[model samples]
Target chain A: MSQQETVLFDAQGPKARRRTMIGTVIGALFLLALAVVVVLRLAGQNQFSMELWGPLLNPGNENFELVWGVIGEGIVNTIKAALVAMTLSVVIGTLIAVARLSLGRYARIPLIGFVEVFRGLPVVVLVYLSVRALPDVGIDLRGWPGGQVFWGLIIGLTAYNMVIFAEVVRAGVASLPRGQREAALATGLTNGQAMRLILLPQAFRVMLPAIISQLVVVLKDTSLVVFVANFDELLSQGESIIRNLGNPIQTFTVIALLYIAINYTLGRLAQWVQARQARGSTAKATGGDDLVPVRDGA
Target chain B: MSPVIENLDLYVDGFLTSLSIIVVAMIGSLLLGTLIAAFRVSPVPPLRAFGTFWVSTFRNTPLSVVLFFCAFGLPELGINRTFYFFGVLGLILYTSAFVCEAIRSGINSVSAGQAEAARSIGLNFSQSLRFVVLPQALRTVVPPLGSVIIAMFKNSAVVGAFGVGGDLWSTGQTLTSARGYETLPIFIGVAIGFLLITLPAGAVLQVIERKVAIAR
Candidate 1:
């Protein structure tokens, strides 16, 4: 008797394809329905006006330039915040990751606790707390006259990113072959020396993709600062425009497009980095699965 | 005012409001996010493309932008733009993108072998996914999804700026606008409420994470 060969259905088989078709059909219908309702409501209210669209579309008027300028400021603010946050998150995250992996329970426990607490907290709450706490501590971020809100947001963002980056950092370090450490010890290098010269650099390179992905996250997170800070980002700027123009749908659509542009660009960048890393690792490929998502359930 | 003592009632009220919005938004965003995630990972190319587009658009766009669109912009379109509805919608949409990515990543983590085994045993597509695949994927996704939920709870505070009623942040703003009360107490109270909820959640996720580690 001959045994029948069984192929993997989990690897995008015919059945999964059928489910995908059904799901897509249902999802498309739902989204189409929602979009139609929104459009009908706008059309009914006469919000789809030529007058509103004309000014925003032309960009010829002085007011249009001013709005564009405000938008420019928002762009600058968003980039600035994301860059600063990303740098801080990487540096602080590295320190925390090291601490968590320390041999001493004293070093390990506190850092682990810190990571969990911040990782668990909502970004908004941290921002609110920062707003209330920073001024009381007598250290004001004067450049942003918006006061507590800006600092609160920055600090909160840093705290959470620290938690996320730390784990990725730690995991990268932990995954290094134990033989490397043994080889380093055999070469007469101290624990710290081996880590600094051998382990840390490799771990950082290995973890760079994950770190960059977090940068995208930090960029997206910058928009959350709009409500708390008087300083306007893309979302805030869009809101202000809609308020002036009274055309929420168009303004929102514009905002969504801007977000899509920036985030999509970042996503592409992350993909590029991943591809490059994959190519680099191909020569030295082993059993390691670097791209696996962290598990949630036991 | 006696520092903390004089503002006890106000603090309690503010805490309650923050807690309520966080809870509601967390649940709503999770359910919405999971569905979107399922769509994104669906096998159909167009469906996958659409899901990817939706997630990317929402994830890339700031939550406040989404909220403002719903709040002020919707009103312009004669949608009434109530605080509750707008806030919930914004959170769900914004968080759903992240949730989808997390869930898809989780689903991807499961080896194709498990699904193959289910199929070899004569299980159908939905049946294999429901029984064998999703169970494994859920385990991997739950902790990260929990973090996303906590993040949603925090982001709901933005709706306060739109003058959304009932939320803790809004209630604090209402109090401040009416009385010349120092902004400190109200914000502190709100922050405390968030801490109370998030702190425990963080611990719970840690526990889940450990269990996952052990299981693997």
Candidate 2:
């Protein structure tokens, strides 16, 4: 059978088209069903009253002051925690990844094990453990007024982000050809010199997307700290508002939208970086495969 | 200090609950993920789009939002308090989205020639997918899927936010608040328990990956 004949004869033709049409129809119906259920439930509870949204949306409403105040504070705390954690995690992750990729087996084994365990543990558990233990060792983390919850949050976020960044960096480094390192060594570069000058820079470019992605993960994971430190990140702030309003639907919906905004912005930033790199590569005369030197050793 | 016998039992009970949730959710996510993966790779454009939307939405949205929406938001809409059930349901839905993408990527990694060969031998699309594509894809996917499962188990801690009647973190919270025993030991215990579950699975996944590489 010819290529054209196969294309025509295979069910990838009309059947696929028909299935697509059906799938769209079903999707529309599903969304409609969901909307109807939501509307009906709201109607039964009279939650659809314009009164609630009015105050919430109104710039001048008194509750708006508290709501936005809490949100603003939460935003500040979230950013602080995420920034601290991101810095710590990246630094620690680099060290750990280096340790894992080290020539010594004994060193590699423990580092690898630590990464696995930390990555596998939940953020809440880490936060809880940190908060519970730090004070007992005379650290008195929580006793310093506002500093207690901040430290706990930082520790928890760092623990998980460390693992993620380690994996990302390791994979990035491994993707580099061994010859790059070998070339560096041929120039009389030391092991550390080769890694820093030849490998780490290139690895970072490759791992840029993964690192950006882990940032979002770390951001959301910050919410789990409410379990331990009880600090008011966006989620906790929303929860507190809901506790006062006795309306989980509206408050949580607001919170969800806020998260979507933050996460979506970061996602777009990552895509932009990726696209720039893609265009840069394509624009250059080196073509695809000939670009980016790969070293098989270093 | 010697471990307290009574506290040990409580910890064991918490571990059991956590383990059961993890097991059930893992199975559910795998099945859900597979079906979604199939849909995603279908020749049908709409199916592919729908699958993409599902995965992207779940992946981007916070797991806490999903848990809270199901547990609290649904109940407001006449879904009664089936906390335990809904808790697992939410986790499965969230985790499966990630799993589906991983599986889809694995499927795409398989050479197109293999599928063509399977079809040339008179196998249908489903048969080719099952015998030729899936087996290969699954072998490549085990390591990532193991990571996803482990992540899901860790994420179930979010279910504690639902004020669920029982679970490890919730029980720990209850005990800590009531007994005022140092929350440190219990927290450490839970972390260790979580590590115990995921580390072995991760090791097994690596072993399998190595075996597959050797076989190849």
Candidate 3:
């Protein structure tokens, strides 16, 4: 059985092994050719020239200062928008999730509709509509600094992301065995108390990793504010830099790298949280057995 | 004709353009994503690393950043094209990462026993994967793929910001500027149009998912 499992094939046979090796070589060659073509094209356009790249590299250069200043402000604005939206979404999402989970069909129906519609609609459309419609409907936020566009973006992001978070939270709560809430009730806790004290805490733990990853998604999506809204998030800042500097490649490259860095860090943190949770569960399982052995041996 | 009715042709044309872009980008991403997923699960170390690198780099970067690079950077590199071309290209490249991930998870869901059985019959890796693994994997993956496609459809809106004409987004912008004060009605029309496309697609996928759900 071990041998059968170990060899997924009949030791690949010599002929098959040779065929696999040939296939690998061909695949490598194809990739190399594609890379070479791209490189040559870029080189032909003088895209590799130091002149196009020097300002980005030299820290003290005026161009470097200008680009970084705008990008830095863009990053801050992006973070601000993302944080405000994320906070609002989480609060609203939790409320909706709980209402859907605990309330009657009459109450749940509207919340469900809210989630489905927002989830179905494209976020850009929502953002565009918010930015345009809010002012028209007499909610003139233009009086405040960056108020109209900022609030418009935040509202749109919140509406969309809140629905997603609602689903995540609901799924988290649903995954718990029915016994948990029932047991909490049996312990003299009210329904609200059971949910608030027992079910939600555990559900929140289960959903934390997903929530963090969604936050990263929200951060990436803040770039959408650049369109229809007069927001200078990183992507728009990169565009402005390109317009001024005539190096679209370098400017957008920096923006992409900045986005990747922030998002990658958050992604890694989520993974770490997931890993820790897995480890904790396993340790608990073994600890139960280990306690028995110690008690018996002693 | 009412304003919305008068602009019906523009909306229809925009819808068709969006649909075409969606069709092209969806197909491109699916094919590229399957290839990347294959690389990810391949026995070759370097291939797996490359696949990992590709998904990480593309997935973390914003779609707009990718679009900006493709639209502006490609032109600077002497690869000038219509905005539609670069827009669809950017959509495909960015979304393929997500598709790769969804499919990779689907591949993981396929039982090891199934692969073992295929291998025991002297089938090679590609052959077994193509004939046995992927069919089952794709059935489980329909739901996630639906979400990815929907996401790509939504993201197609971003391309319009770069002046790619004849999409719902651009049409909305045109109407908004044309009427100037009818922003509310024009955007409501656009949102409804998107909802019509997406809601049906989602319903159909959910039906398919339920029908094909493998009983464990």
Candidate 4:
């Protein structure tokens, strides 16, 4: 009985079991108290009143129409910015990752510096700088699709996500058994052909989950554009709605839920990809599971 | 002093503000994260369920949403506070989820035999975890924990956008607006400031990780 599978803790004796019951009761009570306090505080502030939440529920309200319209636009813009940035980052990241792996010191050293600098710097700073600096450099993107803010936000997202994707690609390539690349070269394939034909395909297959997870990170990070670039993405749009409607609680809650829904779906997609990859390959690639999204500050 | 040199104080002040927020949030997240990790690995089902719920909820939601909720929404809920308080609280709430995952992974790395042995010797759940499992688990998790901390430091820049004054990013904004067209130098300065902190911290953590690493 004692040697039975006890992954967490051993089966408890009567006395230990009683102690656990008491502890659970106390913990439950504490949580209940905390919830009560929060509710009371919010109620005291009139946050629960119909006035605060009416606009969200009332379809005929002009404010409701405006808020929803802005949020819809914000969603489109967020997706647009994220897709453009993700595409640019993946392409640039692949190039840099390959260069870093194949090239000598002159090429690799500068690339390494670029990755490190951008990775360390906050995304918000990069976006802010791009918004201000790009125009000064005569690359005004104001005449483009979503205008200056859109391009600034995309550039910023690219700068940070590119470095991350580069790391992912490098890890993917490095994780492949050396024999895979060597066998291609031994078959009279050029170095480029060997890499393109044999190595990169396997690397991409192994790294797809991580790459998709990074796309989710990029999507969430589009919110940061609101801060520096004056972009009316989902969060900023929510902010504007709150300002006009004076229902910060309701507006922010909806925005948070929307973000969670999108990011949660993306997260689940990443997990599903990971599961499929595991089933497809007998030789498990290391380091792909560790590719959790790192922080992207708003 | 040139404008860049003359604006050293702004950068210094910003650095200090960022450092303070990072320090506070790091400690807060570590404590909260460890508690959540304990819940996650507890023998009880409800504790584990609560821990999983917490991790999924916070982990899936965007940090900006969390920050905005704390900074703006809380004030409307009669919890008015300084921007620093709300920002730090938001950061701690969000980053703690990642930290909890890191710690949980650390906890998982400890051999099952260790815990079973401790139970056989009459050590209870908390005691066994404290005396046997956690020490080994924490050592293995140092590198991942370092990355989480660095992420927290970078994420602190988000506070700057929400009228949270006295951070490096905010200072850069001030400098840029004041200097008008000279945005490049100010931003470059800001980037250097961030690297100065993150690079050294990463290097130090690597050294610590190497030192404490257990041979498999």
| Interface RMSD per candidate | 6.9, 7.6, 10.5, 4.1
Interface DockQ of each model: 0.42, 0.43, 0.43, 0.51
lDDT of every model, 2 decimals = 0.69, 0.72, 0.78, 0.80
Candidates in order, TM-scores: namely 0.83, 0.86, 0.90, 0.92
TM-score of the second chain in candidate 3: 0.91
What's the TM-score of chain A alone for every prediction? Answer: 0.81, 0.83, 0.86, 0.91
- Between prediction 1 and prediction 4, which has the larger TM-score? 4
> Positional deviation of A150 in candidate 1, in angstroms?
5.8
Pull out the clashing pairs in model 1: A296-B140, A297-B139
Residue-level error in angstroms, candidate 4, position B96: 1.2
Residue A178 of candidate 2: its Cα lDDT? 77
- Candidate order (lDDT): 4, 3, 2, 1
Under CAPRI classification, how is model 1 graded?
acceptable
Q: lDDT tens digits, residues A1-298, model 3?
A: 2232232234567787787687677767777887898888888889888777767778867687777889899999999999999999988999989889888978778778778888877777788777778887888877776678888998888988888878877877777778889999999999999989998988787777777788788898889877776788888887787788888887777788989999899988887886777678842221211111000000
Sorting all predicted structures by DockQ, with the top scorer first, yields 4, 2, 3, 1
Model number 1 iRMSD: 6.9
**What is candidate 2's lDDT per residue for A63-88, written digit by digit as tens?**
88888788788777777778788889
Which has the higher TM-score value, candidate number 2 or candidate number 3? 3
Off by over 4 Å in 4: A1-6, A60-62, A105-107, A285-287, A290-298, B44-46, B111-114, B117-132, B179-181
Clashes in model 4: which pairs?
none
By DockQ, the best candidate is 4
- Model 2 Cα lDDT, one tens digit per residue, B1-216: 223245777767777887888889889999999988867766545566678778777776678777877887777778886788888888888888888977875776576677778888999867877787778877866666666776787787777645554667776777667877666765666677667777787778778778775243
